[model samples]
Structures are given as C-alpha cells and as structure tokens.
Target: MTMTTDTRPRTAVQLQTNGMGDLVWHAEYFRCIAEQSQGGQVTVIAAPTTMARDLIGHEPWLREVIDFDRRPRNGRRGRHSGLDGLMRMGAELAPKRLDRMVMFSDHPGRAVIVCWRAGIRTKLGYGATWLQRLLLTKAPRIAMYDGPPVTGTYLDATAFAIAQGFCSAPLVPHINVRPDALARMRERLAAWSQPGFALSIGSSEPFKQWGAENFAELAARLARTGAGVLLVGGPSETALAQAITAGIASELRPQVLSLTDAPVADTVAAMSLMRACIGNDTGATNIAAAVGTPAWVLMGARPPLMHDPSRMKMLEGASLADISPAAVEAQVLAGLA
Candidate 1:
C-alpha cells in the first residue's frame, strides 16, 4: 500500500475552554492535527488548566502548550485586558512564526485577529459571522444547529489538510499516562479482588448531575457483583461522594472508595486503571472514555452531540433524574462483558 504524505509548515491550534469534556475532544483534534502535519511541529494554544496540560503535554508530536489567559489580567485598565490582551498575545506569538493556525472556538474573532496580526498567513476556523469570515483566511461553512457533533465539526476544520494527504492516523483522543502514575494507581487498587469500575457522581453544573441516590444504588449493585467501585470527582464533589459512600450497605462499603480531591492527572491514571466507568456527563466521564475505559455516561438535558456516543454508552433523557439506576447498571454490565 502506498502511503501519501505532505510535510506542512508549523501549526498552532487554538481550543475552547467550555469544560473538560470539550478539552478532551479538542485533544483528539490536536492528535489529528499532529498526525496530519507530517513532521511539522504542532503547538496548542489553550486556557491554562491542568486538564489541558495533562491531556496533550506528553504527546511527542506536541511542541508546546501556550497558556492563553482568558481572564482580565493586569487589572481593568491594564494592557492585558480586552482587545489589548489579544494584541499582546499576538505580539508574543509573532516570534514563533506560525505558518497556519486552526481555531476550534465558535466566537474566535479575537483569536483570528491575533493570528492575523501575528503574521500567520492561513487561518482556518468554523463560523458564519461576518467578522469570522473577514478575519479568517479560510472560514469554512458550518451550521451550528444542524451539524454533526462538536467534535466532528472540529475534525472537519482540518478537512483541507486531510484532503491534501497530510493525515492518515485514526482520529481519537490520546493521553499518555506516566509509568509512575500508573504504578501508584495499581497500588491503590491492589486490595480489590476483581476489576474496579469508576463511578463519577458529580457535574460542574448541578442540573447535569444525576441523583446521588441513583449512584449509590448503582454502586451497591456493582458491589454485589464483586466489582469494586472507585468514586471519582473534583474537590467540589466531596459532599456528593460522601453521600454515595454512606448509602452503600455496611458490608459493601469496603468495596467503594472516594478520591474526590485527587489531582486531574491522578484521576486520569486511575480512570485508565479502571475496567469501566459509569457517570454523569462531566469531565471525568469524558476522561474515562478518552483513556479507553468503557464509559456509560448519563446524558441529561445536554445535547447528545456534546459527547462521543461511539466511544461510550450514552443514556439520554429529558433530565438526569429521568434515567433509572437499573438502565445504567444494565449498560455497565454490558460494557464489562
């Protein structure tokens, strides 16, 4: 088989900061860009978050992770505020001499302006706004309401490069787990008699979360089957984790563990160690799916397109409370099987 190849110029990708799930999908976009760039260095310009660093920092194809501060820095009247900050960012990036820039954000007019001021010749992004078209050298036609999943649209943004025979690798989110981290996760799970399942019971928004009682029921059921449950979430979810932990029967309580305060990287390592995951639509669930764990995500009112259904079992309803524990358990068992 003859493999086509194209060595493109250095590329930079500007990503959105909607949430961790969005970051995970954007990481996949980075992978596609890297693979498609041939040997060219690829840099990721994104919000400074541990999630962003952990997702793509270790990829060999990644040259750098530029921290793009979205907040009002240097005070209200400082040069780092508003349009001035965008210009400053452009000035800093100008030295890098980026050849082409890809914007994965919807309202990236400022970013497009930054790229233009930075002397980047080619700017590719998705948007129908006049400013988007006027600023971007290659603004592709996109329908936000009647389009594929957000991730799919992100992939489409790179269609020009792919068509030029620059990318052939399968488009999937890739996150490398450090060996030491993996070892620590294994040590932590050493007491488990069987494979463990990660249960994520928290969401950034309260409405996105399924009832804690539902998670407790699912945990108890999994415990009955001899599978240990690892409760995972951020610090804000400590209360919810405790509620689920306390709901488990006294005997089964030993099989459940909570790491709500663990670092994002450690959580990713732990997710990779788990046999599968069952959770509400959140960053942790997205990480589980991205790390190759079979994730059964509870999709409440959020659009199903926000997630990658092909990588996990998505149980969608008008609301998170509408999805019963039994339905989730069935999907979890199927994934484990």
Candidate 2:
C-alpha cells in the first residue's frame, strides 16, 4: 500500500508460493503483467524448490529469483523457532522502492505478509482467505469457460472467475517457451524425418498414474505410422517407463527414451522435443504444454477444465479422464504425419 502507481523504472516481485499447478497458472498471468512493465526488473521470490527454479530460470521474462523458503516457518502455522527465517530474508531486501508488487496466489494465506515485509505495495490477486483481501490494492474475479460447469452456480464450480480490467474474456492460462530453447529442441528433432511425440504415464499423486500397459498400446499404434516416441517422468517412474519401453520392444521401444529428475529438466526438454505429447494429468503434462509442444494431455480422476490452452491442441473437452489412448494416438499420428 506504500508504493505508488508511477511509471518509474523499478523492481517487481511475483510471489506464488503454493501448488505447482497454481504456480504455473500464476506464471501465465505474470507473463502478461510483466510485458506491460516495459523494461523494469522482474523477479520471483518463491519457496526454494526445483519447480520454482525451472519456472523462474526458464521463463523468458523473469530476470531474478529470490528464495524465501523459511517464510512459512516464521510465525503462526510455521514450524520454525521464530522469525529468524523471516529476518534473514528481510536483511536481504531494501524497502518501499518497488514500482509494483503483485501477489499471485490462488489463495494468499499468509503469502501477503511476506510481500508486505519485503516492501511490496501494489498487490494483485484472485480468491482470498480471510486477511488476504486486506493485502491487495486490486483483486479481480477472473472468468473463463472451463467446459460445462461442474455445478449450476459459478461460485460452486471448479472454474472460478478471476476478473481483470474491464475485459470480459476468461483467462486462457499458458506457459511460455523460449525461442532459443525451442531452436535447440527443433534441431534435435530434425534428425528424424518424422516428427516425434512425448508420452508421460506418471504422477507424484499415486491416483493420477495411468499405468504403463495402456501407454504401450498407444505407442505401438503411433510407431506403425512412423512417429517416434519419447517417455518422460520422475525417477520413480523408471519402473513404469521401463515397462512401457519393454512393451513396445518390437519397434516402438527403441524410439523411446526415459528421463527423470526432481527439477526434471531433462524430461521437460524431452517434452519440448515432441511434436505431440500425450499423458495422464501430471507435472510432465503441464511441462510439455508450457514448453510449446502441442499436446493431447490425458487425464484420470481430474477434469480437463483444470488445464490451460497454450500447449493444448484445440479440442472440446473438460478433462481427459475419459480420454482413450487410441484417441490420443490418432491425434499424435495425424499431427506427426
């Protein structure tokens, strides 16, 4: 509330310290907001994690990253001794000098407190929990069509509208891809005469895993048509990815590659290389779409309305839980050919 809305060349911080999916959605909003900032320095001050690094470092817009991992442990709810973590981070920051500060969290439980402490003023956010609304100068109800509503009331639906400006258009969530990164991936894919595809059959959440046997069937059908396959996921997914590779050992397996890392950059790069990507609703699915690979994202349990469109092939559906692998294979083969 201290920083004025001036056109000064100043620093801005986007605080998105929540779930990876929410962070990804917030990143897209940050992208649009950063573009309008002209040449100001932009940074992401998130809890230290691999996902934060991949997003901030790989994002074409952000210039800096600050880790305030201990903020959660600073006070009430936080398990740490006191505000040592808070003070440690405070010593690093200088106050009230920012041009603007946008608090981009689905729900800013206490994330707003950190922004205020760091000398941020111009707060922007969507849904709030209790004290959250008091922190933002502007809070818009973002609106968008997420297929048919799960409930009759918009408030009751999974698709909540976070409105912005005077525009009535719904937010089309997306992740940005670097041209240089894309150039490298494109060159790599060029080695093969046919366009390649990515398949992800893993998730941190056990319920989200779509199983390897199902993927193998889809991989085989794509191979028959000449599209190469690359499987990417977490290290724990080795057993699953291996099973998939073995299932298509006759031909498709040789074309497939497996990669896993906590930050999982190798898998992300693999996702980018594919002309088309198919997978269960999971981190890699988001990574593929964020990196610009046109995807046929498959989902199980979760609904499709939860996904963003920059990486999705234009289609009509709410979630991929009902998605058949053959349906995805047809889309992949056609895109590759």
Candidate 3:
C-alpha cells in the first residue's frame, strides 16, 4: 500500500453499494483519509440498501450519506436522465473542487457516467460494464468468488486499487466495532441473556429465511447444551420468533430471549453479546461480523463469497437453504464449544 502523494489533497467519495458488506469494503478504501487526511473528506453515496447506512453513517469519519430511492441508475440503457442524478451529485461535489476521486464500483453501469458528469479527472475503480470502462483513468478488471465473510473480496479489491496506484493510502479493514452498537446490544441483553444463546434467524429478504421450525429446533438443542437461545429481528420477524418460541419445548422457554420489538439498532448491538449467532445469508450476518460476534451464517444456496469469511464464527454448513437444524446447531456448537 504505497502511493506518490498527489498533493493538493482532494475530497474523496466512494459511490456504490451492492450491499452492506460492499459498502463496508469500499468505504474502507479511504479509511486513512478519514483518520490521516488533514483536509480530505470521505463521502459514501449509494442507491441505498435497506440498512447500509447503519454501518457507514455511524462512523464519524464519513461526512455525508446520500441515498436516492426513486431514481435508480438508468444511464446504461441509453436513458440519460440518470445522468441528471449524477449531475446533481456533480453540483454538490463541484464546490469542493475534487482533487482525486475513486469510485469503488465493480464497473458501475450508470455511476461512471455520473462520475464523468461530476468532472473527476483521476477516476479509479473496477473496469467493469462495457460502455463505462472508457471513463476510468485507472479501472482494473475483477475476479469472481463464492465464499463466506464478504469483507475479504472487498479488502482484496481495495488493495488492488492501491497497488494499481489509484489511491495512496494503506489498506486496513478499518471496521471498528461500533461503541454505540455494542452498548445498545448489551443493554437489551442484560436481563434476558443466559449462559449461551443462538441468534435470531431472519433476513429482510423472504428467500433468505431458513425455516422457523428448524431455527426453533436449533434453539432447543442449544438450550439442552446449557445455552439460552435468543431470537433477534425486526417486526417482520416477530411471527417467526413466536413460531420458534412456541415450537421449542416449554422447559427451554425461559432461556429464549425474544426481542423482535427491540429497535433494529439494539438488535444489531445485541448480537455482540451472544455466545455465537446463527442466521440465514443476510445483512444481520454482516452486522454480526462487524461486531466481532461469532456467527454461523447459512449461505443458503447463495455463493459464500457474498459474505465476509474471516469474521465468520463457523464457515462449515450446507450451501442449500434448507440446511438441517442439526447441521446449523452443530456449527454453532463448534463455534461456541
């Protein structure tokens, strides 16, 4: 991670978000600017994933979060209005007079068009998307992967960006376990937490859910092993939590911590206290990894490369969605035991 200083230090913004993990990975490309850049500013703008901001906005180093839902990137199909959004971004960025811009996109189809509109001279990003590659001053090709703990690819990508000379900062994962996230998690768990707990199994996407009955069975087994089972999710998951709770044997009910009513911020924080979390492939898994909480994430047929592999509590599991309750429970035990 070495670079010749392009003095006249400029404002750096990473524009793109494929997911929470993607946002985390690319945002880190400018971590030094957040910590060491005396005058550089870091802005993360994306089309907004459901809870992506929870990870970035929480960080003090990041200055602004721009999310536009109605206007999806449309420059690719030849519709020019999407460039209008980029123009807006350009106007917003114009005042600062950007010295160096690195768009952490994997060949952003329409975003590169916007970057051009914004007038960034030294654009650095993955050279993907056919029409857009010409826009990059330094756009490298990307390799594909399938594994757990998504942060790895992101880390690799950033290192590539630096090695290629787009950026002049050292690469570090740079994800600090959010202090407020930890406190909120602990406060929610204070009374209900037991010796051990298997985490809530839910995702914002319907396809990501492992059956609630299976989740309940895992909880029952963890309870038998002297661990309390916690069900963590947003309101959408209450029924699943209830079903998991009802299905578990009455004796283990006391050990079951249900906090679907708890605010999402708290749910994310609460994950840190769990002995180990188990869940389907989703944002919660990334959140769990960010907090250093041991977790067994069921990729559920999705490629493993989609999540961070290093932070995983357990990487051994079936790739299928209907991973047996026993299979997940075993991984949780392996992580905890």
Candidate 4:
C-alpha cells in the first residue's frame, strides 16, 4: 500500500477485552493506522488484563495505551463501568484532545458516548446498535461479524480505517519481539540445551483445552527428539503445566520447561526462540504466530479462525480430545524438518 501524505490527526482506538489474543490483533491494527498516517502514533484504550502497554510499548508509533477497566469482575462493577465511571473516564480522556476515536464492537456502548463526552469529533466504528450508529460520525454499514472474535475486530477496524482514509491497505497482524524480552528469555533458557518447541496449553474456556494427557504425550515425543518442550501459559495453568511435565517419562522430564510464570512479552520472546509452537487456540498461540513462529493451533472444537497463514497452521478435529498427540507430533516434526 502506498503511503499517504495527508496531515496526521490525533487518533485513539478503543477495545474492551481482557484477552491477550484480542490485544495483539488490535495492536497490529494500531501499527497499520500509524504507518498509513505518515508515521503518526495512535493511542489505545484497552482492558488492563490485555497488557497493551507492556506488549507493544516498545513500538515507536504507539502514542499511549490507556487501560479500559470496564469488564465486570465477580459480578461487581469495574473501575470504569456504569454512569459515574464513564463520566470519570471521559473527563480523564478529554485532556488528550483526540481528533478521531475508533470503537470496536457494540458492547459496553459507553465507548462512543465517552468519546462524545470527551469531545472527539471524528468517530469511527461498526455502529451495530442504533445508539452507536447515532454517535459514530463515520462507520461502516451495520452487519453481523461472523468471523473469529480474536481477529474479526482487527479486520473490521482496518477496513473502517481504509474506508475513512486513515490507512491504505489491511496490514497483516505482527508482533515485534522486544530485544529486552528476548534477552530476558535467553538468559532464562541459558541452562537448556535447545530452544526446541513451545506448547501453549492455557485456554480461556474448558472446551478449548487440548487436555494435559495430550500435551504430555506431545512433550515426551518432542523430548525424545532431543527437543526441549516449553509449556507457555499464565499462572492459572501452573498446575496443568506440572501435570504435563509429570506425565512425561522420568528421564525426559528435565527437557520440559514450564514458562507459565513469564509475562506476555517474555512469553512472546520465548516463542521467538522456539522452533515451533503446538498448543490450544489461546492468547499464547496468537502471540507465537504474531512473533513469526510457526504456531500449530489445535482447533478441534470449532472451525479454523482467521490467522496469518505464513505463521499459523490449524490442526482441526471433531473435538479437542479427538486431536491426537501423534498427528500433532508428526506435523510439528515435519515443519521443523
């Protein structure tokens, strides 16, 4: 896509999510907007759990990342939920003087109103709801988004950006593994003989998990090949990581490393160091794909989601349990070869 020489305008993207995969997709869109706008950095308002700042803070084109804590936790109102919170957020944002604001999805409905309250004139979004359409100064026609949740918003956002002259073409989703992150992981893995393969084992839902037995078997197989298996996930997956490691043969257990404690950036760095990543369709898998690692996502319970074909490959089956370790091992080994 040819670069535009139009005057760069102050822009902000609003996405409400706690998921890291969603955050990565949105960050790619942010970079696209920045590149097309003559290298103008764009601000992002995202959910805190997404760690938008920590993940892409190193990017020169990222103006800032504002944490949007509107998701209800334990049935209680979030810090930025309800009428008072919205006003507070709007007041907080008013100082930025954003020329344009982009909102993804119709949920919360507060983002558009907040932008309006913050006096952001040029607003862009899907405008699925009547109120959202009324508030959005520029938006695509109302339509159902039938694509995968993780990548759909990014596609929609890029399409909207192009339509509004914010960008030229759709930018492929990518993650630039931070140098510091890489160094940190390198130091952490210095003891291991091989960077080997990574297993992204954590899933937001129970149905998405490929089960401990499957991952353990895959880890054992990889270890047999003299490959160190890195189990990547959040703290919640520690027990599962332990179980998978335990299930491995006693002699091969040391080859399996648990990286559930590593932060998002470090996890991405770890994936960068790996030969390939085989795991559930989760945020960690998305990170691996974005970092240009060959990610074999186990998509057994659902259809293949949108992903960069060059970096992500789907291994589909009737169910998560049905996707055998043997089949996955064969593909991963072949890919490495």
Across residues 163-200, which tens digit of lDDT does each residue of candidate 2 receive? 54412344444555545555655665555535676777
Ranking by TM-score: 4, 1, 3, 2
lDDT of 1 by residue, 1-337 (tens): 4343655767898875646676776665576677656464588887664357666676787888887776533344434348878888899899987888877766878787788779888887765577777777754455444454535543554453344344553355546775666788788778874678899887776777787899999999989989889999888789989999889899999899998877687888999988888887677887888888878878766556434456677778777788888887786687666
Model 1 clashing residue pairs (backbone): none
- State the lDDT of candidate 3 residue by residue for 165-206, as single tens digits: 646654433355567867776766677637656565676566
Candidate 2: misplaced stretches above 4 Å?
Answer: 1-6, 9-21, 36-38, 56-60, 70-84, 127-130, 138-168, 179-193, 261-269, 306-324, 331-337
Model 4: per-residue lDDT, tens digit, 1-337?
Answer: 4545667777888886677888787676777667654347888888887888768988998888888778754676788887888878888899977787776656636886687679888877776677767767845554645676646666666666566565677666687988998999999999995958999999988888889999999999889988898989889999999999889989999888999898788888999898889898888888888888889999885767664777888898778788899999998778767
What's the candidate order when arranged by decreasing lDDT?
4, 1, 3, 2
Q: How does each model score on TM-score?
A: 0.84, 0.72, 0.77, 0.91
Task: Name the top TM-score candidate.
Answer: 4
Each prediction's number of clashing residue pairs:
0, 10, 16, 0
Candidates 2 and 4 compared by lDDT, better number: 4
lDDT of each: 0.74, 0.57, 0.62, 0.80
